[model samples]
Target: MVMTKRQIFVVFMVLVLLVALVCASHVTINEEEEADRILQLPGQPKVSFQQYSGYVTVNHVAGRALFYWLTEADHNPLSKPLVIWLNGGPGCSSVAYGASEEIGPFRINNTASGLYYNKFSWNTVANLLFLETPAGVGFSYSNQSSDLFNSGDRRTAKDSLEFLLRWLDRFPRYNQREVYITGESYAGHYVPQLAKEIMMYNKHSKHPINLKGIMVGNAVTDNYYDNLGTVTYWWSHAMISDKTYRQLINTCDFTHQKESNECDSVYSYAMDQEFGNIDQYNIYAPPCNKSDGSKATRQTMRLPHRPHQTFRQMSGYDPCTEKYAEIYYNRPDVQKALHANITKIPYKWTACSEVLNRNWKDTDVSILPIYREMIAGGLRIWVFSGDVDSVVPVTATRYSLAQLKLETKIPWYPWYVKKQVGGWTEVYEGLTFATVRGAGHEVPLFKPRAALLLFKSFIRGEPLPKS
Candidate 1:
């Protein structure tokens, strides 16, 4: 039907108003992002890339907020994918380990006096987003005191999803960007759970997250297999005697909700008497010398009745590196620059929260079920283990993956980087398994170049270099 001149003018006016509204919305989101941008971090060297950090309130009623640092890709950031990284402790800060020491661009110096550029930072290939998740870890916090003690896997995943949805709203430019979730240790639980939440949300939401895949290193998968694998790794690597191994196997019932006294005795004896002073996270690396005199005591000690508690605390490369993060992040200037701790949190910033770790209310005994679900859902899944990690050792990952009973797609073979063998990889029907040679629990810290190569391959959906 033909419109009258007046009707046409009204339609034109509505179109003009819609365009104006879109422009205004875009400008507001950009302004919010700019407000959160990092002008300059106190000891950092000038660089070409942009960075932004701030908090996204996940639970307004609970006054819970999570902190995040986004290091944009070094070049052509708009063309790159966004990768979110988390570190597992049930309570570790991604800023402390993943950002400062592993895949992020800056490395904190020994004295915490300065920062240096890492040539192998993962930001080269994607925009790296590091999140200090769940309230009470790192700069993340809650006004409600009980939130700290009540956190667990389910709550953590829910809060992370809320954070991402809110964060995407604040940075609308990245609303449709392809996203990948990566982490280690307990993040094995975090990454998949968050992805599942996103997948489920996408089915009903107006704007769905473009989640591509996930990769986890030295992950905590199954309690029974991980515990069995840890004991076997220690024995095979000669960290403990054959007799001690047999004793642990006989007494430890990983399936039991509680640790038997006999199991505790054997485990403690194995660590204190049998295992030497070497770092369990990286058996070949020397223990942290700069650690407070308590390192030895803490290393040998195991928390009672908590599955994976001992290993969770021990997951790091330079044991004292966390000390540096503590020093750097706790600086008042650093807090001001990152726009963190605006609430004047009462406690000092720590790498991991003991309260959360100790009181975490629920943990899935096995993540394999989620793995099968994700794999069947057509998500790209890659699991890598650092061979030298005695805590959640390669053996543990192998045992856990074996339970999936997947058909092999590619025979096991060495994958190379820079003319040297970086790792061994074997592809299954839907999952990929790889081992980083001579690497520890924190693989990137131990083998940055290889880690970057692996990340590139994962993002490109290419196999690791066979040459």
Candidate 2:
């Protein structure tokens, strides 16, 4: 029980070294986070929440980096769950849609001259993270041009996983925080696919992502079912002529992976002729009128040789909000404020990438398999449809969910918000489906109050309000 002086000195020195290491690690993380913080956005109204934006390099050799914007909860952020939002064109910018117009706290003004508060921002309840995924979307990019040209579902999922892993290291406080993934349109594939990767990674990693659930709106689920449902929606809603509907049903073989000329002709006819100048994403909403006094041009997806390339531009309550996002984000001062486009990307910022959309290498024919796997694993899964969205209508979602054949836990019924019928909901054995009454493709933008209520219910693992 006698300790020598040298032994005591060695133990003292070891303790000092450990403390230094800990302090150094903490300082480094703080510095990295501070470097990405946004002091103030151009013309932004005063706000209490903290905002950060920057890039995480997911591939060094390819020099691929993804941009992200984080809006901490309005109050007591540490107590809030972290929700990541994605927008899917397989090439769309979450920053443009999710942050600028939908769930993020700020909305771009009509003139793009200033920012205004969104009363229904999801950040009121959760820490919101918006990602510009798969380089070539928004401010994200790759030094290897081919990476942009050849991006696909598999690569996108892998890159996004890498981004999350590295991003968590930068913001270690959220490593064990409850996390939920959400998106709309093609992110039907992105959200589920990314969750599957996270689940798989957790199996072997000592530090696992605290992934709790996932929600997607107007999502693309299955090729056959989605296509079948889309045609049916047009016919039922009287957006397309019966002849056009029949042609679409008979010519476009949803089960086939390749596009046929007859299918292409009929599909184009339905959009160009039968659909008129109205916004396809929101059947009842007015289309964006150009400043030059011309009608809004149709922006349909008509890829010649590709399958599952049916995503069109997602619009908002202000049909021209996407245009305003383009004008705002491309500004030098705005980019500087948010620490984006640091590499001086060759192209202007856009809501969606045309090159990536056209050149997307792979598309999943069906995402129901992943749904089944996740449901069996007991993860909270929710799929919501904006009832008025013709692109991915309520009928399409119903058709896709029907393929799952899940027993109904709660029979379909109207869900209320503020004593008004917000939508209809039906809880199944392992999944929850709801529709946002009169909402468009971008539910949050078209029906923000209802969307936020649905989000609150999703994270709470509670049913939509019955009253």
Candidate 3:
């Protein structure tokens, strides 16, 4: 084999190009060094800093990058539990829920008015940390905008782990503090996986994570159970009809090997109950639109984007509604809290829809197995649910808890806060199953008072406030 001058040159050029492409694909990596973020909430309870703005460099698909200006907790260092809050949607930002709606220093006054102080903020008892993770959420950005899309559970957990490492490095004091991971919805997947990873690393790493317990609300831990639970939740809420319920059982076998017409029928029924409009129903309940050229649907469903918002117009925007949060987040003070350089990227606090234009591989991990592992290793496991949620019902959480088969050293009982019964708690199978009384899927939002109480007790290793 003889190598000609021209061929060799061509081969060399191709190799150079390949290397250049690889470099260009990952040019935006970075880490933080002694940075501070500040926020101010006008007319809210006075604190040294009304907002929390900090930076942590993360290595993801885009290499080194900084996630900037997530909200912080009020100083209660003595009893402050290091709490991490996560928002679901698989692509949703925790900054939206943790800061704007639930237990942040401020609350959105959706009437285009201004910000309001949340008297029941969780920070009063714990040091909360809200993160916009995976290097593409909220203030978090990468040199590669393409990094914004195509994300999955494994990547999310890894990226979050990096953020934790960096965060702990910056705030080393909390390394040995009680760390509790809590989130809602899709976080059902995120929190459990992250906790498992932390627990695993702690077992063998030179620098172990002082991992404590985790809590999820209206969480989606088991896809199969969750899908069926959706039907059950809706039925319990009286959101669907008896006829439709019967149709689901008769036609759809939840355990069937394949998707069937019966399943389609059940889905359609649920959709009709949710949103009456064919256009609106497609967003979340697409399977329920199949009906005979029938009379008008039972009742036109509200737009999925902000149905709960409209439903709670007279009351406060149901913290459950994305609209409620968006309306408040769009306020000027809220923007100040963000501290993002919008010139670098467009920051829309509330996305137009839930479907994220991203791609990523799905991993198979079970919370029950992870729970058992953590328990075996002497790590605490807490599973909390909002009783009123129709999204991830309390029943499903109970089912997940039962699978662990841990002994019931502590009996089920009520816990109290502020002299008012706020929720229930129990110790079973070496895990705690607690409930927040008036919350929805976004437990903190709907039940901040109870949520704060729950967090305080968690950090102190005490029983929850009983109702």
Best by TM-score: 2
lDDT of each: 0.86, 0.88, 0.60
Ranked by lDDT, the better of candidates 2 and 3 is 2
Error of 2 at 4 (Å): 3.4
lDDT of 1 at 91: 82
Number of clashes recorded per candidate: 0, 0, 20
Q: Counting only residues 3 or more apart in sequence or on different chains, how many pairs clash (N, Cα, C under 3 Å) in candidate 1?
A: 0
The residue pairs found clashing in candidate 2 are none
Error of 2 at 159 (Å): 0.4
lDDT of 2: 0.88
After superposition on all C-alphas, the RMSD of every candidate to the true structure, in Å, is 2.9, 2.4, 12.1
CA deviation > 4 Å runs, candidate 1: 1-16, 291-319
lDDT of 2 by residue, 1-467 (tens): 88799999999999999999999999999999999999999999999999999999999999999999999999999999999999887788999889988899999998999899999999999999999998999999999999988999999999999999999999998989999999998899899999999999999999889999999999988888888888899899998898888888777888655658988888777777787767777777667778897665433332222222222234335667777888999999999999998999999998888889878888888999999989987899999999988887889889989999999999999999899999999999999999999888889988889999999999999999999
Q: What TM-score does candidate 2 reach?
A: 0.96
- In candidate 2, which residue ranges exceed 4 Å CA deviation? 297-316
